[model samples]
Target chain A: MDLDMVKYLAELGKLEFSDEELVKTANEMTDIIDLMDTVKEIDITYDALKDNHNAYLNDLREDVPAPSMETAKVLQNAVNTNNCFVVPKVVEQSLSKGVVIKWTYLQ
Target chain B: MDVSSMTIRDMRTALDERKISATELEGEYIANIKKYDDKLQSYITVTEELAMKQAEQAQKLIDDGKAMPLTGIPMAIKDNICTEGVKTTCASKMLENFVPVYNATVMEKLESQNIIMLGKTSMDEFAMGGSTQTSAFAKTKNPYDLNCVPGGSSGGSAAAVAGGLAPAALGSDTGGSIRQPSAFCGVTGIKPTYSRVSRYGLVAFASSLDQIGPIAKNSYDCAMILNAICGYDPHDGTSAKVNVPDFTEKLGQSVKGVKIALPKEFFGEGIDSEIKSAVLKAADEYKAMGAEIIECEMPSLKYAVPAYYLLACAEAASNLSRYDGIKYGHRTANAGSYEELIIKSRSEGFGDEVKRRILLGNYALSSGYYDAYYRKALALRQLIREEYAAIFEKCDVILTPTTPTVAYTPEMTSDPVQMYQADICTVTVNIAGLPAVSTTCGYNANGMPIGMSVIGKKFDEATVLQVSDAFEQGFTPVMPKL
Candidate 1:
């Protein structure tokens, strides 16, 4: 896996990893990839794979418009619901903090 | 009479016959809870007033001949399940005060059936750990030996039934939460086929594998609870559309021609020698009763722990994002910015194990390595599921030890990896999205309980229960008291 791709993905997830953390995550990623590569060697019967690997699609009914909660009704439950859920905009820095801690543990 | 000793099916029968009132049953469980809960730490909060109130209301409906299947039977609900207008803490400090505005879909189903709610049982924080030791408040101890863990993250639900707090309880299974705890505490629990029970209102933890199930004294009681909760829900798109059976009615069928498979992966090196003997003894009993026992070969099953941890925690990292200081939970009074508030609230709110998991999940799904780790893990997960699907064609149900070992004392908390391996025999069922049940088979040399796992075809809970009920009724060894 490429570091650029890792950085880009981490950024997309809004998790900021320190340079040191990035180096470590990259190595760990390589290790896991190696394991997956090893496991990937097992030969799966094509018939079994085709039979069991189909994606499930939900059976949907025709859409009918239904009244949802009124703005005020929804706001009543929020600590600060604006017309929708009210909140202070999340700062980019804080967003990364949650993600950063996660990567730290992975490393 | 000790309400805890009577099975829910029998209790429901008596309540329905007017031989005993719903109110009378509620009082008995409450009395036992008061007597035993402190020693076991099985509950975070007891709702005696609320429960008695519901019991009285159920009795009025019964008087009008309006009782449902679970009407008047008291139940201990794992705290993680949302109960509208009441706290659903998930045993985490983050949402210690946040009560949902609506009941979880399972709770709604139970309310419709008029079941008496005893209280919220204790659990690992956010249903994250093997032992209830990771809960924000306090750990739930095993009923048989107070020094050992009751197994977790649904430990309290297991302990409650075992210690006679309540006859049955609702528990969530995400990577063996229900089965392991039930086994540790010497009770029976079933993790229904994924999406067989609705996940709406269950605070998500790997939405793909989470299931709502029951822990009971016996398989019959487990079937009784399943009758009330299993069915489709529009709220959970993945919920099965198959017809829910008359569970109690279908039980006691012969097991002569049914094929049961024992996964080769389940009997390997990680298994304790003593626990291994108990499990083989269960298989032998099934053999004597004329069922064919064969080995299930699934080479990919060993990856279950890593795969489950990755998928579950990754979802958990995102799901728990809502519990910031700005939400209705523990908020930091001091912070440098909106961001600092989140980090501080989270850092302070989550215990070490919880933090460890969130971090691991975050790491597994981190951008650059998503396909290499999380997604790849998912593909392997599918492989494991395929393995089960293939084997199910040859067998009616699969059987294995629920956990690789018996109860672990609190000392194992220091070694996370060793403690985690305890769920080795169980998590694959969750990973494969299959319905499975765990019933006590025997006890180890020291008398710690051992459990047997019975995995069934998707949405085919009936076969699993039929075989389990046969063993639970007469053939299997009763778990010796710890």
Candidate 2:
């Protein structure tokens, strides 16, 4: 993996690192990916997929809503909240266009 | 009685005979923690106030003649398992101040029995790494030797039990987390069959592979705790509906004619000679006790480590995505945009190992690499599972060393690959979603504990516990010189 690819993947994962750390991370990831090359030798058969699918499918429960944590307690761990989680400004006025909104709060 | 040294059975006898009150038992453990925990760094949050309250309530229950086996027993919980109103940090700065409003299903079950919880123990950040060194908090040192690490991400739970700070503790295992630490700390730990234990309130690391199990001084104690915590729950979608058996009932049964397999593939080149000899010697002990030992081969398991890393990291990437700045956990103070805020929060909150796994996972799942890595790994995992099934058809259980080597000084695992290799001997059990227990066999020349694992079929914790308990009957654990 290239340094730039590491940066792109980091951005996709919503993580940040210094440029030096990214370079180091890229190298480490390259080593890990290389190690994973061992799996390529195995024949591709869907036996596990079949077993996994069957095991997980039949275990579903009825979708009834059960009692949940109280709203005050749920919000207790929130860093920025006023009966709801608070996030940074996601909407800004575009210089060449009408006011743009990036997100809207759920009611 | 020294409550810290007493097993759950011993403590129960004391409590029954009025030799010790529940409050007195809790106080003894707290005193032990105060005397020894700073040197070991095993706990993240010690809940003395809550423990005392619970102990008082437990005394009322005992006096009322309503005590369960687990009632009034003080135990530590891995920081990853949620506790209502108490901090569950997962040893990460991300959840450094986060507290849950509800208990995990297991925690609720333990509470119903009036078990006294001493504290939240340390672990790898978000249960990501093999060693506790990756914890954003303190690294838990091995009780046997302070310079060496208690293997992790369940190191704190293992260290606490082995150090006699807590009689028993709870830990979640994903790729040998609980077993490895227990082996290193000279305690017994069980990683039950996948879906055997509910994962509802466990902070998810690898959703498919994680199972919560008990770390205790012996397999019987492990079975006792398993009885209290094991059962199906509607809260965890993956929990199996299979009837929960009385695990302790299988104890003391004859091992005569039991077919035990020694997979030659597991005892390969990388394994330390001492561990191999000790584990083989343990197999011989089983043979002397009338169990038939046979050698078997499972070649596909060679790919387990790589396949496990690929699958675990892939799941981790998806599961850990929930930890953005908006909800619970740490949030960044300043950011120009919403994306920037999330990125900055994650970067600042997660430890280096957690970030590395996320990066690897994202790379594996990236557009061009998905089939080459993730899909291939899944197929390999299936092949490995099938191999286990084929082997189990002729064998009641498989025996192997819990880890290739005994506890190493924490610094020896600085390189990622070196740390990953430590899990090679143990990851196959999790990959196959099988039940296995790591119990003390003997110590190496350095005096660090060596553990042998007895693996049984899916949800067949009875056989696994029986074999482990049988071994414990003839074996003496090497207690760390505290």
Candidate 3:
């Protein structure tokens, strides 16, 4: 469990933890990984994953456009919304050599 | 009968006879909450207005001779179940202000019966831990002993039922959340077979493993609530198409010739001696009732803990990825980029246990480790399920301790692995997608309740409840001194 691996995992999960917390997490995860090693001993193959033994088969319903919640109710919990949830600008204006590059192509 | 102490059966009868108005019962529960919740802290939000309105509607229904089984019976919903126009916080700051616009299928069914919801109860944040101490809002103490934790993540539901705050409650069990708390609180709870109840609006912790069930004063009350809630729904893809039986049909029936399997693995090392003895005593009681108790072996169960955690965390990571502060839930105040915003929101919003699971989930699904951890665990899960299927061929129900020990002090929160081990006796039922019930067997010397579980085959909840109800025959509920 490298410290850098923990950092990479946090980034992947869209989570952030302090260095001290990450150290603790790495230690704990190492122990869990060790515990999980026992699973490798079970002589099971990939074909077993397909046999889910559950009654919930792929009973696909008709592809019909159904009514959904009202837009007003959907936007009720938005932190920042005018007509939609506000997010940080995806493609920002990059400044290069005292000149701003307007990314018109992306827009 | 004490209004707060009455079960759903008792309340329904009383309401039918016009001995009590629905409003009065609601008031009684509210009064009980006011008196005892200061110590138990079972509720996160109390819906007084909604309860009153529902009670009024229920009274009118009763007056018109159209009362359903659960009409006017007050319930405390585990915070994970979505309630329309009510805060379904999952006991985490990430959804501290989150309110769903639609009701969970269970809640909608209960609403059709005019059941009154008292409030949302406390749980482990995102239903991740065994102790209620993981809740970001408040630590729900066991009603039996204020210092000890009520087993969770349905601790609040159990504590409220045991403490006489609400007659019954709905609790979700991913891995023993409902049963463990019921055992610790000296009450009765049932976790139906997966897909027996719809999971349409349950805030998903682990999609395949989670099932919503009832925690109540007695097995009969639990069955009554189950009758009201269980059914197939078009909205839930995994909802079963089988007919929901009247779960209370076999109550008080003789257990003659019923063969119960006592898995040797559950009583092995690491189980508390007292819990082991109590479960054995319960087995003897069953024998006295003419039920056969056979010793069985489930070698694959040894891998249950790791397998459950791996699958649950993997599904949790994927199921919870939707909460990136875009549409609902807590969002960060400011950010210069979408990635930074998601990072900051998750960092600030989720509690420590949630972050740990997410990180571990990512690690399990990471490129190099996926084959070693996630895939193997999945295969192992099937093996565990197959082992149970084989055992059920010989036994009608499998008997075990609901938890390895009774309620412990909240100090167990310090060690995550130790906390996870608390679920060892119970998680296999979830893995097998079997119906199991945890009911009071006896009490530990410290006065904390000990529970024993009856696990039945898939969609065989009737047998599970019958066994539990018969086993609970002479055992009276132990009320907290609060």
On lDDT, the candidate that comes out on top is 2
Q: Write the per-residue lDDT of candidate 2 for residues A34-89, one digit (tens) a residue.
A: 77788888778555436755466347787887786676776788887767666666
- Second chain TM-score for model 3: 0.99
Candidate 3 local lDDT, B381-407, one digit each (tens): 778877898888899999999998888
CAPRI rating of model 1: incorrect
Using lDDT as the yardstick, the better of models 2 and 3 is 2
lDDT of 2 by residue, B220-326 (tens): 89999999999989888889888998889999998989999999988999999999999999999999999999999989877888899989999999999999977
The better candidate by TM-score, 1 or 3, is 3
**Model 1, residue B35: C-alpha shift (Å):** 1.4
lDDT tens digits, residue span B346-443, model 1:
76777666654565567677766576667766777778877887888888888888887788888887655555556678788888888889998888
- Most accurate candidate by TM-score: 2
C-alpha lDDT score of every prediction, in listed order: 0.78, 0.89, 0.88
RMSD of each: 6.1, 2.0, 2.8
TM-score of chain A of each: 0.48, 0.72, 0.74
Query: Candidate 3: global Cα-lDDT?
Result: 0.88
**Error at B13, model 2, angstroms:** 1.5
What DockQ would candidate 2 receive versus the native complex?
0.67
* Deviation from native of the Cα of residue B376 in model 2, angstroms: 0.6
